[model samples]
Target: MMENKPDEPVDHLSQLPVLRLNLHELAREQRTEQGQLALRDLTRLLSALVAGHAAVQTGQVDWRVRGYTHAQPGGDVQPMIELKVSAVLPLLCQRCLQPALQRVQDKVLFRLVEQEPGLTQEELEAEDEALCVRVAVDIQAMVEDQMLLALPLVPMHEVCPQPIVVAGLEAQPIDLPARASPFAALASLKKGK
Candidate 1:
């Protein structure tokens, strides 16, 4: 007979059956979870990938989530969640028009508040976000959103792999066709006059 324990952490991502996370329970238990999501599974993210790499089977994003409570002013307790995401994306290089591997890694802290508060000047500078309480959080969607934010506005290789050709400097002289100047006709007409 197989036995399952609620407190024990499950190391294998395959064992996790649920996609939505209960934030209230997660913060109460202060649980930490790590998993890998296949690139093929994220349809919206896959669409942003290069055409050739759209069907890549080995590409995946490694994500780790930790939930806990933070103490606020005036003896108030706040629920918080920290998410770390990392992934290597195969993107098209805008410079050489080829594939360039890019690694995207980010850590975001979200505070699950009963009501969202207006951002202060200091809060704007911090990476933390005030999130309203929800029934369930779609972990995959959060991971996808983070990955999308990490994508470069313009993907490029450090050094372009294509051959370079400098202007005003040629290895070979280009062939040219000889032609008479426009003033030649004027000279002929002047002579006729």
Candidate 2:
């Protein structure tokens, strides 16, 4: 049996777990934050997101996200969250079909819209990064979405492990026994009749 120490005390804050946050509330309060997270926690979420992707390797990379939520400029009262995500992941090179390291870095600034907008041209063209935060936001999911979007359209090694070679079919002629044409048979039957 070991003796209990009275002098030392545990610091719980440092060991506290990170939880999903309400982006709207954070924005309302106007705060700046930063944190580091492991890929292990997001295995299932990422598996579904990257199912068809060649580089579906998971649990090797770590993510770092930094952001600040504040009122948008130009006298806009609405809040905007600007976030940056950085990570390095192992991806399959399309050229060689082998594993290669890929660096993913993305930044997004979103102006939180309270109500879902009706069908409009601006909503159609809102690809520049704007999201409506009506409920608590899952930071992990948000970062994963950014990572998935940042994946290269065509992932390839700058210098492939092996060179790709394409072979063309060579033209060749096949020999076959000659057969009477249908018209010849028809004429023969007509003559026989």
Candidate 1 segments exceeding 4 Å error: 1-18, 119-122, 164-193
Q: Assess candidate 2 and give its lDDT.
A: 0.65
In candidate 2, what residue range of length 10 has the lowest lDDT sum?
57-66
Cα error of candidate 2 at position 149, Å: 1.6
List ranges where model 2 is wrong by over 4 Å: 1-18, 44-76, 126-128, 165-193
Itemize residue pairs with steric clashes in candidate 1.
Answer: none
Q: Rate the local accuracy (lDDT) of all candidates.
A: 0.82, 0.65
Kindly list the per-residue Cα lDDT of model 2 for residues 1-193, writing each as its tens digit. Answer: 9554888775533554755777766666777666655554555435533344434434433444333455457866766677777766666777887777678787777767777677789877865456777777777677777777777778778898776765674356567899989999899999997
RMSD (Cα, Å) of model 2: 10.2
- Every model's TM-score: 0.71, 0.60
lDDT of 1 by residue, 77-101 (tens): 8888998999888888887777878
TM-score for model 1?
A: 0.71
